[model samples]
Target: MKTRILSLILLTVFASAAPAQKNEQNRPPIIDAHVHAFEKDERWTHKVANPLTGQPMTATTEQSHMQATLAEMKKYNVVKAVISNDYQAVLRWKAASPDHIIASYGFYDPSSQDLAFLRREHAAGRLMALGEIGAQYEGIAPNDPKMEPYFALAEELDIPVGIHIGLSKPGIAYDDAPKYRAALSNPLLLEEVLIRHPKIRIYVMHAGWPMLDQMVGLMWAHPQVYVDTGVIDWAVPRKEFHVYLRRLVEAGFGERIMFGSDQMVWPETIGMAVEGIESAAFLTEQQKRDILYNNAVRFFRLDKK
Candidate 1:
């Protein structure tokens, strides 16, 4: 009986240890360069279907959403994330998980007062980056004169600026943002901004999907520019996403691409986004690591952290 019991105990120990070891091998540390936080509101209480899988994603309250996001981060071994949202929401999420969160300022249109507030936040060490700057939704191009001040601020502060430069929700112009224009999605529109603010650190969010030629040209012209595979990583068809990603890599911009879930209300997309990169058979393990973590560390200056 003692021999049998000891054998069973050994089996149990090995069974428990096997999965942990496998998980460690399968899930490498990640640094999500794009994420969002939202205030608890009725807006998130409805199920939204995933565009790629067509599966309904459960809704959550503000508290539950934060909890779920953090849980997802832990599960995937996401060491860090750059989170953008309204000021209060960003603060709450940062407070809840100080070590995991990098606070970013999210804005649509900004006034001088908003710039002042951002300046103060940065001065106080509360804000690290500025973006998800959805100026495109307002029909504003990256080089629009109205956006000069914001870019100037970021350049002056030496913080990275993330701008929305590509596809939004389907029919966004018809229903959600009437000002949104497909022409504005062209990454080339940012050329002037890069020219004027040569020193500004900028990342084109969504990797300027569906605009492959322009995105590659812009990156070739401006080596300082980086991009994040945000919503396109999970929301688009897997094959399509891979084609776009592969082209960028083949064009020799692999080192500049970073991973971003563009995760809004659905926490599951975090895993989906990570899998999107991991599933790319064309990317070697080292290239995958660059996109998933190393690039962001260099882009965000996380080594200082």
Candidate 2:
């Protein structure tokens, strides 16, 4: 009897909250600015063996991952998602859902991607952006010479770019990626990249978490630089994430903030990320709208299309 009573109360709260959250759907279109559509079975091998340790990572099947991600996308009224994965999978996802998926180039290194292939795809409109460029996970700084050419190419093609920066999981260095360094997580290092590639439309993925001051300082110094709240939105403590987000918005970087789920193997994380922004009491309704959709629309030039 007590269990039944509790279930009723819980259902009531969920039912009541459903309508309130629908207001989010009533707003502008949502764009998930970060995603990786790697086939689940091959996800672990996508990055290849860890050089230092010659070890492998775990996996997620492609079909299952896609089905779940798409369902969640629908559930939340996401009109578009910027997806990054291995070349074949990325192409297939875009080809399969061209209208809903914005194909992006991603990997730990630019060298892993063929420049000619990327150029051809970008020319043909199959690849819309270059990103989740992630060499930062390998202890690389964005300003390194290795990344400048791609930055130039992105500017030349007028394609937006996204790069990983700051606050990866603790002890990530001991995992599959031995090069991971928490010290390299600073967004200030991106200043040189921004200065050199003034025309490139780039967003710092993960919003450079735990580097709030550096993130804010970088955005302040380089107004064109944008950010996406990805893994941190769902992985971090709700209150902690809110505090970081609130600080960014309070510091006057709201317009540049966008949504990204970084939904790898777990598609359920998409809703969690959305809720992170939506449930923030510190954020107003309009602010939520901006973070969920409007800012991304502007950042990705969706309005023009």
lDDT of each: 0.83, 0.76
TM for every model, in the order presented, reads 0.89, 0.84
Tell me the lDDT of candidate 1.
0.83
Error of 2 at 10 (Å): 29
**Colliding residue pairs in candidate 1:** none
**Candidate 1 per-residue lDDT over residues 1-305, each given as its tens digit:** 00001111111111111113225435778999899888854334434444555444454566777887888888788889889876688899899999999999978775433777889999999989998898888888888899999999999999999998898877767766788888988999999999999999999999998899999999999999999999888888899999999999999999999999998876878989999999999999999999999999999888733
lDDT of 2: 0.76
Which residue runs does candidate 1 get wrong by more than 4 Å? Answer: 1-26, 54-56, 111-113
- Candidate 2 per-residue C-alpha lDDT over 1-305 given as tens digits, one digit per residue, 9 for 90 to 100: 00001111111111111223344455456789988787543333343322212323222356645765776787778889999866578777777777889888887865555788889988887889998788877667888888888998999999999989876656667765677777878999889888888998999999998899999999999999999998888777888899999999999989999999887655657777887888999888899888988899899988622
Residue 206 in candidate 2 has what lDDT?
Answer: 92
